[model samples]
Target chain A: MDVSQELADYAAKHTTQVLERSQPVQVDMGLLAAFDNTPIDPSEYSSDLDAHLLQLTLTSTQALISALFALPTTPSAEHGPVIRPPVPSTILPREKPLPKPKEPTKWERFAQAKGISHKKRDKKEWDEERQEWVARWGRDGKNKQKEEEWATPVKAGMEADQDPAATARAERKARTAKNEKQHRSNLAQAAASSSASSRRTAQQARAADLERSMLVSKSATASMGKFDKSIEGEPKSRGVKRKFDENVPKAGWKGEKEGLLGVLKSVESGLGRKEKRKGETKEGEVVVRKAVRYHDREERLKAGRGGAGGGRGRGGARGRGRK
Target chain B: MRPLTDEETKAVFEKLANFIGKNLVHLIDRDEDDAYCFRLHKDRVYYLPLSMLHLATSIARPNLVSVGTCFGKFSKSGKFKLGVTSLDWLAKYAKYKVWIKPAGELPFLYGNHVVKAHLGRITEDTPEHQGVVVYNMADVPLGFGVTARSTLDTRKLDPMGIIVFHQADVGEFLRDEDTMF
Candidate 1:
C-alpha cells in the first residue's frame, strides 16, 4: 500500500506516452502537416510560454508520427521499409489568378453560330486497295495517293496538254495554300478585334499617308500638275505654296547682304586656309641662303682660287662678271 | 521664285568653286550697289542682282520665264549641273584654262573632249582631274571640262589620248534650245 506513490512515479517516467491535449490533433501525412484546433488555457499559457508551446508542438508531432505509422508499408530492395503518403485532403489557396481564355478564331465563331460540334478524326485511314492503314496526311500520306498511283486516268473533257499527276499535286498544294491564307485571315481578325481603338488609329494614319503620297504623285507630272488629267470629284491638291522674302521689306537689303557675306566667309574659311598654307613657309624655319652662299664660295675656291688673296680675287671676278 | 536654301547655296558654291577656286569670294563679296543673290525658280538657279530682283518681284512665278543669268539648273535627282549660260562667270574667275587649236575648236564645240593633238596650251601646275575652262586660240571661252591629266602628265600622253573630259559646252545652247530655259 505504501509503494503506490512510488509505483505511479516509476510508471510515469518509464511510459512512452506523450502529454495529452484537450482535443485531438489533425494529421495530414501527405502534406506532413498537423493542425491543433484545441482551445488554450490562459493560466497555463501565461505561466510559461516556452513550456506551453513546446508541449503543444510535441503533441502534434506525436500525432503525426502515429498517423505515418498507420499507413500501409511495403519493403523496398534499397530501403528497409517505405510508406506512400495519401492524397492531401486540404484545398490550399492558389498563388496566382485564373488564366484568361484565348480569343476564338474566325472559323470557331462561324462554327459556333452554325451550332457545329467538333468531331475527332483518326490519324490513320484504311486503304481498301493497299489492304493496309496509311496516314491521313504528312509523310507518304493518303492525300497524295492519287498523284502517287501508277496509272492515273485522264478525266473527260480535260485538255490534251494537262498532266494527271501534276494536276493532282497542284490541287493538293492549292488546298494547303487556301488553308494557310484562311489561317492568316483568322489571326488578323483576332488581332483587330482584340485592340479595336488602337487598330482604328493605325488605319487612319495609314489612310492619311496614302492620301499624301497620292497628292505628291499627282503633282509630279512634267507640267507640274497643270496638264495632268483631273479626276472627277477629286479634291484639289494644294501644294506647299512658295514662301519668299519680301522684295521690299521695311528693313533695307543691307541685312540680307550681310547675311550673304557671312555665308561666303564661312565657305572661304573652310576652303582657302589649307590652300593658302601651300604657298607660305612654316614658322620658326631657317633660311637656306647661307647654305647657297657656302656652295658658291666652294665652287669659286675649286676654280683655281688660292687662300690668302681669295677675297680680292673673288671681288675682281665679280667685277669682270658684271662687266 | 524664292531665295535658295542654305543647302542649295552650299551646293551651288561647291560646284562653282570647282572651276573658280577661291575667286568664289569675289562673287559673293561685291560693291554694295552691285550686290547679287541667288534665287531658285522651277528647279533652275538664277544669279540676279538686287535691283533686278526688286523689279522681277512683280511678275508671277509661272509667268516669269527667267529672272537673271541662268547659272545652272538642278536635275531631277537633285544634282546641280552648270549650264553653258554660266560660262561668263566661270571664264572670268577660272583658275585653270585649256586652249584648243582652231581646228579642234569646231570639234570641241561639237561636245568632243580635248585630245592631246587638239590641246594647244594648259595652265602650268594644273593637277589631274581639275575643272578647267576650255578656250579657243583667240581666248574665247568655248566651254568647261574636267582635265583627264595634269600638265606634267599630259606630256607623256599620245596624240590621241584624251587631255580633258567634256562636261558642258556652248553647243548645248543650240542643241538643247527647247529645254534650255
Candidate 2:
C-alpha cells in the first residue's frame, strides 16, 4: 500500500509542475492554425534543437486536437460527423479592384444642372374607381387603361373612323420606342466616354473584323488564295477542318446501323428544298391534268357530233393511237 | 470511301425516293446477313453490303474503283444527280412505270424523251411530273424519266408532244463510259 501511494504522489507532483510552466495552445479552427505562445527554455533548445522542436510541436498539435473535439458537432450521414467553423479573425485582401460608379444619363445630367431634385415614385398607384392598387406600367397598367376602357369620348374635331383607344395605344408605343432610342443613345455615349476598357474591347473587335474580312477577300480571289502572294509575318490561313466518321467505329455494328436508318428517315421525309418544290409541282400538275382531260373529252364529243362524217378520219387515228 | 454524311445521304435518298417512293426502307433495313450501307467515294455514292464494305475499306481511296451499285453523284454545287448505273435498283422498286412502243425503243436508248407517238402503256392514275421507270413492250426497263403529263392529259396531246422527260437512261453507260463508275 505504501509503494502504490508513493507512485500516485509522484504522478500528481509531475502533472502540476508541467501545468504551471506551460500555457494553453491558441487554436483558430477557421484557419486550422495553432500557436504555442509559451516561452522556450534556451538551455533545453540549445541542448537538442530537434528534440525541443518535436516536443513543442507535439504539445501544440495535441492542444489543437482537443480544442477541435470540444466544438459542437452534428451527425452527418455522408461525413459521419460535421462541425461548423468559426469566422476567421484575419482579414484578407480583395482579389480585384472595386467597380467604377455608373455615369449619369443625359436626362440626369440636365436635371442636376437645372437644380431639380428627383422624387421617388411607387410602382403601384391607387385606383379610386376600382378601389384597388394597380401598377403604373405593365400588367393592367394605367397607361393602357384608355385602350382597355369600354367607352371613350370622341373629340369634337376627330374623324368618325379614327379610334381614340387605338390612337392612345399608338401614342404609348411611340413613347416607348422613343425612350428605347434615347436609352440606346445614352448607352452609346457612356461607352464612348469610358475610354480605357472600351478602347481595348473596340480594338479587339476591330481585329476580329479585320481577320474575317481578310479571310473573305482571300476566298474572293479566283484561285481562292492559292495564287495570292504571301506577306511577311502573315499568319497562315486555316479553313474548317473536315471531320469524318471513324473507319471502324468504336460503338461497333449497332451505332452504324442506327445512323444509316436515321439518314433514310430524313430522305423519305424529302428534307431537301429542291425535292420539296418538286413534290409541290407534282401535286399541282395532277389537278391541272384532270381539268385538261375534261376539256379534251368535251372538245372530242363536240367535234364528233358536229362533223360526224368528217370526224371518222380523226376517230380512226385516235383508235390507232390508243395502241 | 467514307460513310456518306447526313446531308449527302438525305440528297441521295430524296432523289431515290422520287423513283422508289417509300420502298427505300428495304434498301436500309435488311436481314443481318445482308445488311447494306451507303458510302461516298470520289463524289459518287455507292451502296455496298457490310461485308463488302469491310473488304473494300482495305483498298486505298484512289485504287478502289467502286463498291456495290453506283447510285448517283453529288455535283460541285452539292446537288445529287442519279445516274444510269442505279437503273437496276430503280427498276426493281419503281412505284410507277411508263412503257414505250418498240418503235421508240431505239430513240429512248439514244437518250431522247419518249414522245406521245411512241407512248405505249403507263401505270393507271399516274400523276403528272411523277418519276416513272421507262420500260419497253417486253417489260424490259430502258431507263427512268419524269412524266411531262399525267395519263389522262396525254390523251389530248399531239403525237409529237413530249410525254416523258428523259432523266437518266441506260445509254449513259456507254455515252458517259469514261466517267461512269
Candidate 3:
C-alpha cells in the first residue's frame, strides 16, 4: 500500500478550497508608521529547544518519522535564508513499490505452512522449582540453580535394616571423620591457647602406629617350612598328568596283545594286571560277531504285527499267518 | 524380541520341517511316519508342516530343547544332536554306539582315549564314519564324536586303538581353561 499517496488522495477528496471574488491586497500603512520592526537574533535559537512545526497537510505517520529523526534542513540553490524540505531517507523507494510488511519468524513460517496457527513461539512452560513460568527448552539462560544442584554430592538412601558390611563401613567412616575433626579441634585449640602438650600426644600416637606397622610388616612370620611336608597337606603343589609309556597299559586297560576280554575281566576285578601270564588264554579260534538283528526291518515295516499278506505280500489270505 | 510375524512363523515351521525330515526320518519305521511333533519357535503362531505325529504313538525325544535365532545353539546348529536321557533310546535307534565304563570317563574327558578297552561295552554296529554320541554305561551322553574306523575293519584291529574321534564334551562347557601341566 502507498500510505503517503493514500493519505494525499483522501485529503484531496475531503478538503474543499473556498474561492470568492478576489480583489487587490490593502496594506495598513497608518499602523506601520507607529510600530517599529525588530529583528530576532539567529544565535538565540537553541538546537535542543527548537523544533519545526509539523504541517497539517502531511500524514501522521510521515510527520512522526520526520519529527523523530529531526530531518536536516539544507539551503535551496536560489534561496539563501530559506531552508529546503528535508531529503527523504535512502529507505524510501526510487520508484513506486508496495510498503514493507512485517516478516514472520522461522517457527512462525513453519507453523503457518503446517496450518498450525495457534502455536506461540515465545510461550513459556511452568517450572515447579522457580514457582513461575520460565523457558524450559532451547537456550535456557538461567542454569545456575541446576549447576549448583549438580555440584552438590547427593546422599545415598539408607535401608531400614542396614547390612552388616554397610553398617561397618559407615561406622568406620564416622570414626575416621570424628578423629579428623578431633585432630583439627586439637590443633585449633593448641594454636589458640599456645599449648605444647597436644603436640606431645600426637607424636606418641605416631610413634605407636610406626611401631605396630613395623611389627606387622615382618616377612612370613608364620612360616610353614618348619613343619614337615606331610603335615602341610600335600605342599600345595600342582599335580602333573600321569606319565605315559605307550608300551605299558593304562590303569584299567589291558596290553595290546592281551585282548579286550583280559581288559574287561581285569576291570571287573578292579586290578591293573601287568603280566599276561595270570589270565587264561582261550585255545579256541576267535570269531568276530556281526550286529544281531532281532527282526528284519523291511518285514517289520511292512507287516510285523501279523498283518495279513506280509509273507503273502499286501494281498494274502487274512489271519492265515498267525493265530 | 518382538513376536515373529506370520511369514516369519511360516518360515520357522518350514525350517523345522526340513530339520526333522533330515534327522529323524531314517530312524523311525516306514509305517510310523508321523513319529514326533514340536512347536516351531516363532514370535507368532502359524500352521506347522508336520511330517509325523499321528503315525507314531509317542514323541522321539520327549525332552528336546528349542533353539531359534541364536546361532550355534544346540538345535539351532541345524545338525540335530539329541541329548540322551534313555539308554534304551540310544541302543534302539543309534546305528552305532561306544559304551564306556566309569573308570575311563576321566581319560575320555581329558581328551586322551576314544576306544580304550578297559572302559566298557562297545557296540559293533558302529561303522565309524559319521557323528555319534559317546555314552557311558549309565547311558548318559558324555560327549559327541565321529567314528574313526569302519565297523568291519575295526573288529580285526586292536581294541586299544582309537575307534572314535573326540569332538566336544559336556565338561568343556564348564571350564574351557587349559588343564594344569
Q: What interface RMSD does each of the candidate structures achieve?
A: 2.7, 2.2, 26.3
DockQ, each predicted model? 0.21, 0.33, 0.02
DockQ of 3: 0.02
Compare candidates 2 and 3 on lDDT and give the better one. 2
Q: What is the Å distance of residue B80 in model 1 from its true position?
A: 1.4
Candidate 2 lDDT, A64-181, residue by residue in tens: 7888999899999999889998987656699899987897899999999999998889999999999999999999899899998898888799999998888999999999999999
* Residue A60 in model 3: lDDT: 33
**Ten-residue stretch with the least lDDT total in model 2 chain A:** A14-23
* Cα shift from native, residue A37, model 3 (Å): 99
Model 1, span B9-89: residue lDDT tens? 777877888799889878877888898878889999999898998999889878999988999998898888888999999
TM-score of chain B of each: 0.98, 0.97, 0.48
Model 2: reference contacts kept, as a fraction: 0.61
Local accuracy of candidate 2 as per-residue lDDT tens digits, B1-181: 8887778878888888888888888888888898888888899998888898889879987898888988988999999999888999999999999999999999999989999999999998777778899999999899999999988788889999999999988888789888675
The CA lDDT at A130 in model 3 is: 73
lDDT of candidate 3 over A52-154, digit per residue (tens): 1122112333334444445355667787544334344324346867655544544456689999867445556667877887764335633223433433333
List model 1 lDDT by residue over A1-323, tens digit each: 59999999999998655667778898888899999988987998999998888888888888998898999999999988999899998789999998666779877888899999877899999999889999999999999988988987777998989878898999999999999999898878777777787657577889878878878898888887888788886666675886767555458767766666676667667667645443233234544655688988887776545533345556667756775
